[model samples]
Target: MTEAELQQLIFDGLRKIAPESDPASLRPDQKIRETLDIDSFDFLNFLIALDERLRVEIPEADYGKLNTLDGMVRYLLAKLPK
Candidate 1:
């Protein structure tokens, strides 16, 4: 999937976890947890939702790489099947 598609998928997952969040206002370089006030549990659920939607396993070690919108898109772009 393209970066835009991945970004949308991430936003969708975030919506499910944090309904109050305004996806459009999210900064690409900002940390998602801090921006959304997402606790550990919510973040885990968001990751699970993304994994289910994208059919990709995001290992724990890579979680740091997904902390920001731009980072997540770049990480997924590299990991996603060709």
Candidate 2:
């Protein structure tokens, strides 16, 4: 899938998991933890859900790389099927 498609999916998933999230205002450059007030458990759940949906296993070490929305998109794009 294209980067935009991946991003859109991520946004949709986030909104599905986090009903309070304002998907429209989610900026790619923004820090997800800070901007979304996401705790460790929520972050882990996000990754796990994404992995299950995409059928890709994200490395645990790569969690730090997903601090921002753009970073998450890049990581997912690299791991997910095109």
Candidate 3:
């Protein structure tokens, strides 16, 4: 998928997991969990949701790399089929 699509998917997943989160105020470089006040459980669910929608398995080991919007986008971009 394209970068724009990935970003949109991420935002949509965030909304599902954290309806109070304001995606419009999200900074790409900022830490998503801390910035959005997302707890561990919610974060995991968000990741799972992303995997379900994108059909890409993000291993637990790589969870740390997806702390920011840019990070998730970059990581997913590499894993997604061209």
lDDT of 2 by residue, 1-82 (tens): 8988888878877776678978658787888778877778877888888888889888888888888879988888888766
lDDT at position 63, candidate 2: 82
Query: Which one wins by TM-score: 2 or 3?
Result: 3
For model 1, residues 1-82, the per-residue Cα lDDT tens digits are 8878888888888888889988668989999899988999999988888888878889999999988898989988888899
Show the colliding residue pairs in model 3.
none
Off by over 4 Å in 2: none
Q: List clashing residue pairs in candidate 1.
A: none
For lDDT, the strongest prediction is 3
Q: Which portions of model 1 show Cα errors greater than 4 Å? A: none
Better of 2 and 3 by lDDT: 3
> For this target, which candidate reaches the highest TM-score against the unseen true structure?
3
Model 3 stretches astray by more than 4 angstroms = none
